[model samples]
Target: MDNVKKRAAELLKSEAVKVVIGYTMGTNGKPRAAFIQNAEDVDSLIFNAQCVQNLAVYLSKAEIKQLGKPAIVAPLNVLRAIIQLASEMQIQENELIVLGVSPDGELIDFQNFSAIEKYLEDFNMEVDAKEKETLEKISSMSLEERWKFWNEELAECFKCYACRAACPMCYCHKCAVEQNKPQWIPVAAHRLGNLEWHIMRAMHLAGRCVNCDACHEACPKGINLNFLTKLMLNDAQEEFGYTGVTLKEGNLLSTFKTNDQENFIQ
Candidate 1:
């Protein structure tokens, strides 16, 4: 933690970055996002298991871009998000600095996104035991059983939109749910509305989602919306073998190939 503080201070003191986005002490001794602009403020910055929020979400924000250039203290998920963002043209190269955190709590001074991608080659997209068990339980269900199970979960959602807000990939200027002219989705939080909202959001994030669990973390009702997107991610990986962050021109879902499987053509 001290090392991170030192580096952050050095960068800010040298004006290498206009801001250093990382975790800091919040109320009740918790952790939250901290935008450190001054060298002295680096003391508040921290990194740990409790600092679970993916700070990469701010990279796409117009307000954050106004800060000149940012140095984001990124975890593994945030690293993946950065590469994915770069691939989607959401962010350009040399736009910001990345303060990457390794698994052993060491700071990796990634000079560029390509280096992060090479580092990511060794790390597997492994989920925790709890998440693995939950996915297994869901996968064991029959089609009708799965439908019934998910509906029960979705019924509790009151459309707070915390899930959408927390997602880094959901950086659209205007969301489909917010559109009223075509009425893409109903305004109310009814069963149909909730169903459509989540399904559409999952499809939109099919290959784009990095399984950061930001949606799950931000859910006021503890709804596991991350699971739905995770399923979509799994489907894309299993079918297309997409690595989520190819640093390519187009996204997996947006691009099509002649050799793609026609199983869904019907």
Candidate 2:
């Protein structure tokens, strides 16, 4: 955390970018988004496993717009979200200054997306044993079992938008649920309404989700909302044969390719 903050402060001091977006200790000691306008503010920035919120969602905000070019300390998940956003025309490629951190706490001075492969090749360290165990458990579950598991878990949901608000990928200015003319989703709380909301949200994320798990953490019901994103991530790898892109803008996924496979469609 200190290393990242120090580097970010140096960037701010040099005027490499207008702002540095990172995380800070929140009211309850949890990590929350922190926007650093000057070098002095960088000392407050933090990074940890608990820094769960995806900072990517701030790139497209109206108030954040005036801040201009930004040097963003993005989680690997949020980096993928930025790449996906570039593909979707939500942001420009040149506007981002990204730095990556490895799962085992190594700073990757990646200049571009291709550097990720080089990093992986040089990364000979052992994977975190606990993360491997969690992945193994998640992999062992059958789809139906997983669905049933989440159904039981999400049953206590109170329809709070905490998950959406916390996510970096959910950046629509006028969410469909908020539309009064169409009212695509009802405002009242109900199982069906919640299910539809979840479905729509996940569909919107589809190839764009970066698997940050912020949605799950923000859910008051303890629902594993990110389970769907994991499923989507698997689908992206298996069906599209495309690993996710990096956070820098102007990669792929925004433009249509006629040669792309879609035979599964009816």
TM-score of each: 0.93, 0.76
Model 1 misplaced regions, further than 4 Å: 126-133, 262-266
Q: After superposition, how far is residue 22 of candidate 1 from its true place, in Å?
A: 0.5
**RMSD (Å) of each candidate, 1 decimal:** 1.8, 4.7
- The best candidate in terms of TM-score: 1
Instruction: Tell me the whole-model lDDT of each prediction, alpha carbons only.
Output: 0.85, 0.70
lDDT of 1: 0.85
- In angstroms, give how far residue 217 of model 2 lies from its true place: 1.4
- Per-residue lDDT over 143-169 for candidate 2, one digit per residue giving the tens place of the 0 to 100 score: 998667656665676778888887877
lDDT per residue (tens digit) for residues 115-218 in model 1: 99888888766455687788889999999999998899999999988888778888998999899999999999999999999999899988898888989998
